[model samples]
Target chain A: MLITFGAIAIFFAVIIVVLQLSGIKDRDFTDYAVGGRSFGARYQAMSFLNTWYPGAMFTAFGGMAASAGVISFYVLSYSLLTVVLMYLMAKPVWIWGKTFNLRTQPDLLALRFGSRHIRTIAAVVGIISGVPWLVLGMQALGTLFQHMSLGTLSFAEAVMLGVAVIALRQVWTVRMGMRGVVISDMAQGIVAYIIGSAVLIGLIVWMVLARGISFDALDQKMFAIPSVGSAEGPLYLFSLILTGAIGGWCWPYIFVRLFTADGVESLKKSAALAVPLSLIFGVALLIFGMLGSQVPGVSAHPNDVWFIVSKEAGGLWLLGLAGVIVLAASMGHTDGNIQATGAQIANDLVGNYWQLGERQLIVIAKLGMLALTILSSWLACLELPALFSLAVLAYQGIIQLAVPQFLGIFWKRGNKYGAIAGMVVGFVVAVVLELGYPGYLPWAYGLTSGAVALVVNLTIYVAMAYLIPQSQAERRRVEELFDLIEGKRSAAAVSKGVREPA
Target chain B: MSDDGKTNPNNHAAWIIGWFILDAVVALAPPIYWAFDRNRTAILGLPAVVTYFVAVAVFITASIVAAYLAEARSGKAG
Candidate 1:
């Protein structure tokens, strides 16, 4: 127990000390919000990974594999597709972000549609959906702490301690802003994904060869996937993969990764580099979970499979390392959410309403981070069942942003009316269907509520584009934005070149 | 290729769109995955379904690398 706690403590201490030494002071709001838009492929890749897969990857996702079966591999498929989307969107998003000094995802929408109302709507939706996950992230730490204590601490005591540790980590988040978050993501990602993958692979080898826990010995049902004749229907796996691929970037913390890269090329490089890491780590963890189900106590408490197997295999030392990995991943997740949400609050919500100075915006953003940290920590302590359900539904709701975000970038025809209407209706429908059918709609043939709502959302967006045509001026403005993407010479530049020849 | 003797951006875009289509079919298409859903075979001590998806991921990664290289050759990466 002491060794496990000591390992976790050392992990936290190293992260904080490194953050302190690397912290930059006197950064303006832009510098604070997006790390001054200066990071290479490796930093950007790690930051994206840390934000993409929370600590729940170990607990909730691992549990799903242990309990359900191979369906958890949906993460691996969607993650790769998500990276492809990131690569495709890199040029347009990075160019616009750098060109117009866009800081948040909402800022990009507002710039594209020329509407502050759209910005506020996007920002509000982002914050509302993001808060639940932040609370759940804090709760994930509770599980980590409980396991690390080796039965010394009660679940309630562990919950409080986990929340407290995460809340305290917000000090650096609020102080150093995105810079601190990115730097810490590098360290945390290494522990969580790199070392964590190694541990998972090692344990798998030990379990299969030494302990005789091969697939042949396990139940055949663990390998089955839902297919055409299955009860869940054929589209079930398809919907899961599609939702994850499209909705992956809709999370504000994940979308903001676009702004952190140095340029479009760097962002593309990062997307390429992120693929293998996500595949290896995600696959190894799920495989471990699936194999660990054969262990004595794991099937009963599936969520504890990662820790249970670690403790069973190598006893205390490996368990300590596992604890440290989850702790690092969770801390990175919590910090990223806090920083991104804070910047959205200050930049999108408040800054749009009032013209605040840079320093004032920075202060407001920091204050927002502090307030959110406290609120989420308090909510995490409640451990409400309804909140976890909402966090799951939040994924469905967040994907509503995709239509507006992608269309606004690619298709100039999508006006603010369409963007706003589609998102509002899509989010409401997702929530309603999710509440009615918690996970999937049986009536919809295994299609998720999110997918059904997305269909409606896309219909409305396309219809409105033709129904309510943009004014000539707005059309030209949008044309100019697209022109920037194509590298077309502007009228002014063309005239200047001709005149210079004389 | 365009008349300027450079790779046409539209062709590059087409290739990318094609790659994405391939990826979607391989990763999400029910029929494609259903073919491998049987548990009769195991490649690396993993079920056929699991190995199929793992291979799909690698294929997708290679496609992305191809796209990156194409973009670099066309000088459109930046």
Candidate 2:
């Protein structure tokens, strides 16, 4: 345990040094929000992966898969589809961000609708839907810390310890903003994904060969993929996938990635790269959990299967290594949440309304991160349910942004009224249905509450869009925006055609 | 190719439509399997469902790469 904790300390020290050396001169709020939109393919790809594959994927979701069986694999499909969505959106989002110097998701909404109220409402929704997941993510660290301490620390003590460590890490996040976050993400991603994935593969191979557990040798539930007619059937799976794919980028941390890539082309390449890596890690870790079901006591405490199996197979050293990897991944996600939500609070909700300058905004953003850290840590100290459960609710609420964000980007007919209305209706419906009827919608067996809310949300959005047409000025502005997009496309095309053939 | 040798707006729209069609079909297939399959088959020692997942993952990955390359090619062309 000592050696493992020491290694983690050193790893964090190295990351801090690298961030400090990056000399993140975030002169303006734009630089703080998006690293001046200067990251290349590798940095962008890894950063995206690190943020997307949160620690709970290993602990909570993996445990769920271990216990609940094949239905959990829906994440794999939705995740990849989300990447495809990213590829399609990359060009327009990048063009807009670059053109307007937009720093956050609400900034894009404001640009598209030309309304401060839309931006404010979007910012409010972003924070409300985003904070729970952020708190839940911080709470996941309690599990990691407890496992690493080998029962020496109680769960509460472990949670506090995890909170302290994260607070310490936030110092760098506060200092450097997005530049620090992106650079540190690269290092942490390699550790969590590359090194951690290698450990998972090793364990799976060990399970199959050494333990001689055939893939089909598992429980019958493990083999069956539930139908929509069944309990975990179509509606359930569909809801999971639908919410996941549509809402994937709606998370402020993920949506903000649209502004981080150096170019549309770079963004496209990053999507291409990120999908495979996400699949590799997600599928591999889930498999490890599935195989882990064979080990005694794992099916009972499925969340601990990773550590349990690791300790069984390779003893204390490997378990410690696995702990560190999970820690790195979890912290990577937590830091992103803090930085992004903090920036949103400072820039969109406050700065937009208060008319703050860049310097003041940066200060507020850093302070926002600090305040967020303390609040979420306090939340973590209170024992919450597994992060996955909270995350599902978060997904339900955040996906409401899809009607406003995704549609507003692609369809010019969508007005701020529709965007704001759709988001409120969708979010309220989701929360009500989720709280009232937990899994499936009332009367609609198998349909997830999230999916139900989305259907209502989209219907309202479309109805409102057609009912409330954009004003002549709004229509003209939208046309101008699309023209800018076309201009970029034409420029790229002309450059290609006119250049001498090599 | 269309009546015009150059890629027309219709063709571009068709490509996008085709991409979505493929995406939906691919994404929906696994769930359909989950809805119906009784786990009778195994591919390379893993359950058929898992095999289907690997296959779709590969297909989607190839499609993404191809799409990017095509975009890159289009950028290079007029």
Candidate 3:
């Protein structure tokens, strides 16, 4: 059952790729890159589904539930808070991006603080945190479709193959930019949701009509290991839940979406729908975890639950559906990470190096994204590190940025001296804590660096704010930046603003 | 300068921070003490099991407030 489904899934994936390559007309690097940054609310809604229903949610997170206890649910709880996180994040990031006329993550940081130091710090952190998750995804992809009796691809081979496929997908990405990725992400997202719902409904029917097991029984089986179902720690569980909502609050890729929105209203519209969309669609993966518990014979790895169920129910058809969902998850995350990384590199490094034109830099940006895709995919194939911990490590790294930048924006005294020193120190501290602690490294086992970094960061900020002499020009630069963000701009101000090429 | 224009979600973000410290004390002290010191005072001799529920409640409460404040701030349009 698993083998047949996998074959069918491969065929469907090939077809989807061929159609995307041939059928899409406006397939330029830019369009392919950020979906030309013209995504409407409806398409945006679809993109939300693709973004939320990721492999970790479907595949690995279940495994966490199996091993880690009820806290497995905590991974998901963070998702609910996204409603508030997105709303808080969207407009400010949107206004900043539109005003700066930015395209990438590094660009956002560099432009905001007007500091190469900030950009460099951001890029290094992006790569460190991002590389591991890509590897973890590759690991899951390797493990996916294990129903193949031939075992033509061992786990290593599968990881390699998956990474290769991701790299190939980016060929299209390299030429397209956010335009291509977001469009496909939206398409994949909507299709995954619709098809995922159908597939799940189909499975539920089989369980009810064919197997004679009730939903209540299945729920019992899932909850039978109550301790396994719940997460550990008092505050850590809450922290995990909160992290779901706000941890990714300032994620660079998500911020990019804000820039592309039609206006603040689109931002509002997207935010309104993003939460429930994530919670519902993401929960679809949980059904696989639930089913995995019921089938007593299946002793395969816990992550294999989704694949096994897909094969068991409808064989090839369900396998194809599940495959597509995983692909969409990997692609959506990869695209965002790559684009944000590319944007940072292009704006901070490449543009600075060559002082290139918009046409040239945008082209370079696409290539840079391609580079990042390959690098991340290769890392994914290695899969030595654990997933969620790595994600926490990365989250901690990015959230580190939130401290300095947040202070710089909101507080009058948040000067460059404090911003730079605080960011640097916070980053070093995070790295040391991550490295020194064993479980803490790739996953957040010991303590959340968000608190430490924020605390250490604020302490330095307050001290430096008192010590550093406030410069008039620097003050003007920041005030003017905020004013432009608040839309108090003249025609001259608008023209002189956002150095996006003549 | 007067704090009227744009507020940081840090107001509630701070509360999340507070809960994190409480969790560290409740959840980690035993293991931390076990690893470093054989001293019972390090765990503070507190029951580990109940801490999980207490911490979970605190985290959930803090998250709700954070989410509420973040959304409310966004609605204000900077």
Best by DockQ: 1
Candidate 1 chain A weakest ten by summed lDDT: A493-502
Where is model 1 more than 4 Å wrong at Cα?
A490-502, B1-13
User: Share of real interface contacts recovered by each model?
Assistant: 0.42, 0.23, 0.00
Each candidate's interface RMSD (Å, one decimal) is: 5.7, 7.2, 10.8
Candidate with maximal TM-score: 1
Question: Tens digit of lDDT per residue, candidate 3, span A384-482?
Answer: 556667666666656666666556555556665677688778777765675565322224433355645656877987898888856675566666666
User: Number of clashing pairs, model 1?
Assistant: 0
| lDDT of candidates 1 onward, in order | 0.85, 0.78, 0.56
Q: Mind giving the per-residue lDDT tens digits that candidate 1 earns over A258-347?
A: 998887778877887788888889889888888888999988999999999999999999999999999888988888899999999999
Q: List the residue pairs that clash in candidate 2.
A: A227-A233, A228-A233, A228-A234
Please tell me which predicted candidate would have the highest lDDT against the true structure.
Answer: 1
**Which 10-residue window in model 3 chain B sums to the lowest lDDT?**
B36-45
What TM-score, computed on C-alpha atoms, does each candidate reach?
Answer: 0.95, 0.92, 0.75
lDDT of 2 by residue, A47-128 (tens): 9888888888888878987887666777888888888788777766777787667889888888777777777787887787
lDDT of 2: 0.78
* Candidate 3: regions farther than 4 A off: A1-36, A67-69, A148-152, A201-232, A297-300, A377-392, A408-413, A440-446, A466-469, A485-502, B1-78
